[model samples]
Target chain A: MNIRIENLTKSYGDQKAVDSISFEVKTGEVLGFLGPNGAGKSTTMKMITHYLNIDAGNITIDGRSVRNTDMKKHIGYLPEHNPLYEDMPVIDYLRFVAELQGVDAVKLDDRVKDMVRLCGLNDEKHKKINELSKGYRQRVGLAQAMIHDPEILILDEPTTGLDPNQIVEIRELIRTLGNSKTVILSTHILPEVEATCDRILIINKGKIVADGTAETLRKTASGSQVLRVKIQAPSQDEVKESVSQLAGVALVEKVEGSENRLEIQSHVDQNVNEAIFRLCVDKNWVLTEMVPFETKLEDIFRDLTMN
Target chain B: MKTSNATWIIAKRELSAFFNSLVAYILLISFLGFTGFFTWLSGNGDVFFRKQADLKVFFMIANWTLFFFIPAVTMRLLAEEKRSGTIELLLTKNVSDRQMVLGKYLSAFLMVLIALAFTIPYYLSVSQLGNFDHGATLSGYLGLILLSSAYIGIGLFASSLTNNQIVAFLLALLLGICFQFIFGVLANGSTGWISELFNTLSLTSHFDSISRGVIDSKDVVYFLSITFLGIFLSEYIISKRK
Candidate 1:
C-alpha cells in the first residue's frame, strides 16, 4: 500500500501541532521519519492509521481517502509509549491483536507462532507482559504490529528499549519486511535510519526540512570537499604554502598538534586530488596519506534542524 | 470485520480480564451474599417475616446494591485504558468507537446478569415455601436487568469522561443518584407539571411499576432510552479525537 498525505494539519487549541505537512510513501519503500520531540512525526502517523482526526487535509491510502474509508486492517501501527495490557501473556496479546486485525481463526495459531519466532519471543511467550523486561516488551510490541501481515507498518521508536544485539536483529527483520511492505518509522537514532531506511525525511517544528537519501543529504549539506593529508616534506610551512597555492584549493592549514598533517578544503564542485598529487611530485614532498572526508549525517541533521 | 463480531471480541477480552483478576469473584460472592442475606436470612425483610412468596424484598435490596456495584464493575472499563494509553492501541484497530463502547457496555451488563442468575435459588425456595406469583417474580428480575442496563450506560459514560477510575466511579454514582432517588424526592415535594416530569424521569417509578407485574412499554422505553443515550455520548466523546 502507498500513503499520500497532502497539507495535513492538526492543532491543540491555539497551537498548531502539525502545520500543513505533505509527503508520500510508496510501496516497498522504507521512510525514516526524523524529527525532534513535538515535531509531528507521531501525529502524522496517527492520522494515517486513522487514530486521529485530520483537522484540515487529506490522507489517502492506495488512492482512497482515509477519512471516508477504513484503512486500519492494511496498516499496522506501534504507537508511541507502546501501551499494552500488562496482565496479558505475550502469546495471548499477540493473538488478541491478530483477531482484532481480522486474521482468520484457522490461521490464528500459525500467525502467533510465526510472530513469536520472528520476534525471538519463544522463551517468554507465556509470561505476562508486565513480567518482561523493557526490551522484551518492545519486541512484543513489534510482534503484535506485524502479526496480521499488514502492507504498511508505522512504528514509533521501534527499537527504543532493545539491546545492541536485539537492535541489529530487529533492523534485519525490518529490512527483510521492507522488501515487500511500506514502512514509516520515526526515531531519534540517526544511523538506524541509514541502516534501515531507503529514504530519510527530516522534519522540524511540524514542517519538512529535508527529504532525500543519505548521500544526497550529505552532498547538499556541505558542497565543499575536505581532505586530510599527511606529508613528509623539508618544511611543514613550505608544504602548507605549496598546497594552498594549488588551483581549486580554497584553504590549507596544519592540523593542530600535528607536525606533517594538513587539512585542505576544496571549492564547491572542485576536485583537488590530482592537483595536490602533481604538486607533491613537482615539489619533492612525498604525500603519505590523502583521505576524503564526507560530511556526517549527524552534522547534516543538526545543520537542518537547528536554528 | 462485522460490527457485532468486533464488539464480541472486545467484550470477550474484557470479560476474561475481569475473571483473570479478583474483581469477578469478589463481585459475585458479595452480590450473592448481600442479596441472599436480605432475601432469606435477615430478621426484618426475611421471606418468613414478610409472609410473602414473591421476591419483592430481594428485588428491593438488589436494586440498591446494584446501584453501587455496577459503577465498580464499570469503573476500569474505559478509565484504566485511557490512563495506561492503551486506548490509542485499541481504537486504532478495525473496531469503531460505537462498537468499543457497546462491547464494554455488554461486558458489564453480562456480569450483572451472571450475578442475578445466582439468585434463582431464592426464587425456587421461596416458591416451595408458599404460593408464588411467577409473573411478578419474573417481572422483578426483568426490572433489575433493565435498571442495571441503565446504570452501566451511565457508568461507561462517566468512564469516558476521565482517565481516573475513582472519578469515573464517583461520577457514575453522582449521575445515578439523580435517577435513583433525587428525582423521586424532588417529585414528592412538587405538585405541578414539574413534579409530573420528575416523576416520569425518575428510575424508581419505572422500576416499581415493572416489578409490580406490569410490563408497561413506557418503563421499558425509559430504561432503553437511557442506555442508548449513554452509549451515544460515549461514542461521541471518543470519536471527537478525530
Candidate 2:
C-alpha cells in the first residue's frame, strides 16, 4: 500500500488550494501531515484517496493510478470533520462501512465486531452516534475507517475535539495501527506527530516547506544551536566577550536577570558545551550550570509556517 | 461486492434512517390525513356523495397532494447528506456515483410506495360500495406510481443542487409544478409544434392517458424518460461536485 503523489495540483476557481506538491509513504510507515488551517493538508489527502479529482498531476497506489476503483478498496479515509450518520447506531454504522468496503459476507460481522473492540466502542455500540460524546464519536469514525482492514488510512485532524485522556487513548491506538498499516494523519498538534509518525511533512501555503524526522526538522529549521550558561563570573561584558571569542560561538548575549549568566549561540553542527567549560576554566569562573537548548517542535512549526 | 449490492446496502441504510426518525411518521400521517380528508370529507365530489364506483376523485386529490408530499420525502435525501458532510463518506466507498444516486432514489421512492400502499383501504372500501371499475382503478394506481416516480426524480435532482433542505423542497416543488401544470397551461394557449411539444412534456397529459385504462408504450416512455432524466441529472451533479 505505497502512496506516490507526483506534482499534484488542485484549484478552486482562481485560487490554487493545492499546488504542485509531491511525496510518498511506503507501507508500514506513518507519515504525519502538519499544516495550519487551510494549508491544503485535507486537499492532499482527498486527492490520494480519490475522493477529489486530481486536477493537474497524478497519484498512484502501489504503482497503479488512484482513478481505478480498485485503488479505493485498499484505502480508508476519515475526512475532516469526521462526518457520520447521526441517526445510525455505532454498530450499524460500522457494519454499513464494512459492507461498502466489500468485506466478504462471511467475515463482515466479525470484522465489524473487531473494529468495535479495537476502537473501544464496546460500551456504546448500541447507542446512536449523535448521543455519544465528541471523543466517542471520533472513535466511531476511526472504527468505520478501519472496518475493512484497509492497508492505508488517511485521517484529517482525527483528534481535533478529544479530551486529554481520549487523545492519549487514540494516540496509542494510532501507534499500534501503524505497526502494520500505512497511516497519513494530519493534525496541528505537534507532539502527536513526534509520538506516532516516522516522518513528518510540514506544508505551508500549499507547498512542502519541511519534510524529515522530528529531530531532523528541528535541526534544519533551527539553523543553529543555543547554549545557556550560568556562572559566578566577573561581569556581563567580560563573560560575553570571552564566550563570543570561542571558535564555534556565533553570538553571545548577557542574561538580563544576572550579570553572571550568558546566552551563547553556536554553529549548527557545533557543540559549544565543552568549549565553554574550557573557557570558563581558563577564565577561573566557577561554572555552576551549563545547559544546551533544544528547539521545541512548536517553535519549529511556527518558524516554518508563520513566515 | 457488486455495484448493485452496494446500491442495495446504501438504499437499506437510507430507508432505515428514514423509518427511525420522526419525519417518516409525520409524513405518512399527514399524507394519509390529507388524502383521506379530501377524498371522503371535503370538496363537492366527495366519494360518499358522488356515488361513483370509480376513484377518479381520489386520484385527482392524490395527484395534487403528492406534488407537495414527494418533495418532503426527497428534500433531505441528498441535501442533509451534504450538510452533514456524509456525502464525502458515501462517495469514498467502493460505490459509484450512479449507484449512490440510485440508492438514494430508491429509498425515497420506496417511502412513496409505502405511502401509496396505505390507500389500499380506500380502494377496498370503494370496491365494496358499488360495481367498481377495477380496471380503471388499477390503471389509476399505476399512473400515480409513475407520476410519483417522476416527481421523486425531480426532487432528487433538486436536492443535489443545494445543501439547504428548504431550498431543495422549493426547487423540487417549482420543477414539479412546471411539469405538472404550467406546461399544460402553456400548451392549451399555444398551437403548432410548440403546443405539441409542451403537451408531450406535461406530466398530467401522460398521467391522464394512463388513468384511462390504456397503457400506451408512448405514455409509459414519457414517464420513464422524465424519471431517467431527473436521476441522470442528479448523478451528473454529484459527480461534478466531486
List chain A TM-scores, every candidate, in order.
Answer: 0.98, 0.95
How well is each residue in B66-127 modelled by candidate 1, as lDDT tens digits? Answer: 99899999999999999999988988888888889999999999899889988888888888
Model 2 TM-score, 2 decimals:
0.96
Per lDDT, the best of the predicted structures is 1
Candidate 2's residue-wise lDDT over A118-163, tens digit each? 8889999999999999999999988888888889999998998899
**Candidate 2 lDDT by residue in tens digits, B1-242:** 38789889888998888889988899899889988997898867888889887788888888898899999989998999999999999888888889999999999889989999999999999999898889989999999999899999999999999999999999999999899889999999899999999999888888887887888889888888888998999989888875
What is the number of residue pairs that collide in model 2? 0
Against the true structure, whose TM-score is highest?
1
lDDT tens string, model 1, A1-307?
8899899999978888889988899989999999889988998889888888899989998999888636788888899999999999999899998988899999999999999999999999999999999999999999989999999999999999899999999999999999899999999999999999999999998899999999999999989999999999888888888889889999998889977999999999999999999889988889899999878899998898889
- Superposed on all Cα atoms, the candidates' RMSDs to the truth, in angstroms, are 1.4, 1.7
Per-prediction TM-score: 0.97, 0.96
Candidate 2 residues lying further than 4 Å off, grouped into runs, are A234-236
